[model samples]
Target: MTGTDTDSGRPLPRRLLAHVGVAALVYLGVCAVLLVWALVVTARETTDASMAGVIPFLATAPASLAFLMLPANSVVFFTAIAVGAAVNAAIISWCTRALRRGGHPDR
Candidate 1:
């Protein structure tokens, strides 16, 4: 019945930005889960129990992100970033659509 799909009564661009923000939060949650699992596995296997173990686990996620070190090649590094952005955009689009459909059940 309304021109805008958002129940918050904001413009489309703002809604899109909110959708992207939510998607980013989801992305960080996934990364945090990966980081926690890595740390837990490291914790279980080690007998020495030194501070050095904690440092590497904490640094890895940011280091890989900053250096684009995955796949270990220049071309692959750029490709990975592109792929990641595309995936995040897809997630935002999906979330926006879900919000549109769910928020206006009368339609």
Candidate 2:
């Protein structure tokens, strides 16, 4: 379940790939829920109040530190989803790798 990291000689989990998948599920799952909520809110009669754009806007709010090359937008939400997932996966991987051996010292 672990592999050696080339850069720091740390034991990175092989499940890092699985972590990305899990992160994707979590990220997109939230986006889907927000999409549904947005639709529902749009459908309701709220006397000039609505959450159609605002609710789903969160999908693109957090820029991925790991993958920032692609512009996050509706036309590219597919890529953004993967980018978001990879960022979360990378963070988890780094934590697990660093924490595995008394934690790496910041340099």
Candidate 3:
């Protein structure tokens, strides 16, 4: 019944941002789990055979430092994952605000 509620009856961009934030949180959770697994593997005296298989791919990827240092590897991996997730959340927030200001209704 309000300007925000079109015939489809949606609350618009703020609502969408809430959804995006929830999804980003879920993704961050998964990343945390994976980082824990990586740390466990790295802590082992022997290198992870499975991880060794991916060495070529990782070697070609940016920030090769993760493949070299001990604690630094885990730190860099976890930091990058956290930072990337935060950046994704921020971009979603920015887009939502932009759409709302531009008068775009909910999809």
Candidate 4:
């Protein structure tokens, strides 16, 4: 997917979005595997200090915040996650394109 088309010439964004949607599934699959690995590791480990800190933070921070501010933070977190996913998708797409163009047979 170069920015332009070979024949019918549809806008790149439409094509890119479709490609990204499919690619996102591959990304999600890898994430699911990692999540399962993390769960297995957590279950096997007797103690994890970083994980221990999360409960106190989640419990205390929300109670300390104003009710109105809580929703704003939730929106910000969701936006951040979306932005991060888009950036990751872009990087993956770029790398895939680059490798293909560079004639790396692995792809």
Tell me the TM-score of each prediction against the true structure. Answer: 0.33, 0.39, 0.42, 0.39
Model 3: residues >4 Å from true position, as ranges? 1-20, 49-75, 92-107
Best by lDDT: 1
Identify the superior model by lDDT, candidate 1 or candidate 3.
1
lDDT of each: 0.54, 0.53, 0.52, 0.49
Global CA lDDT computed for model 1: 0.54
Q: Candidate 2: worst 10 consecutive residues by lDDT?
A: 1-10
Error of 2 at 53 (Å): 2.1
- Model 3, residue 4: distance off in Å is 14
Runs off by more than 4 Å, candidate 1? 1-70, 103-107
Give Cα distance to truth, residue 48, candidate 1, Å: 32
Model 4 earns a TM-score of: 0.39
Root-mean-square deviation of candidate 3: 8.7
As for lDDT, the candidate ahead, 2 or 3, is: 2
Per-residue lDDT tens digits for candidate 1, residues 27-105, read 6456556445555765777664444333333433333355454556646543444455445556666776678789776
Q: Report the lDDT tens digits of candidate 2 across residue range 1-107.
A: 14443434433543434444445445556766776676577678675335474554556446433334557555565455446544554565556555654644752
1-107 in candidate 3: lDDT tens per residue?
66555435556656654557555455456655665666566567464744732333232234333334445454555555555556655665567567666865554
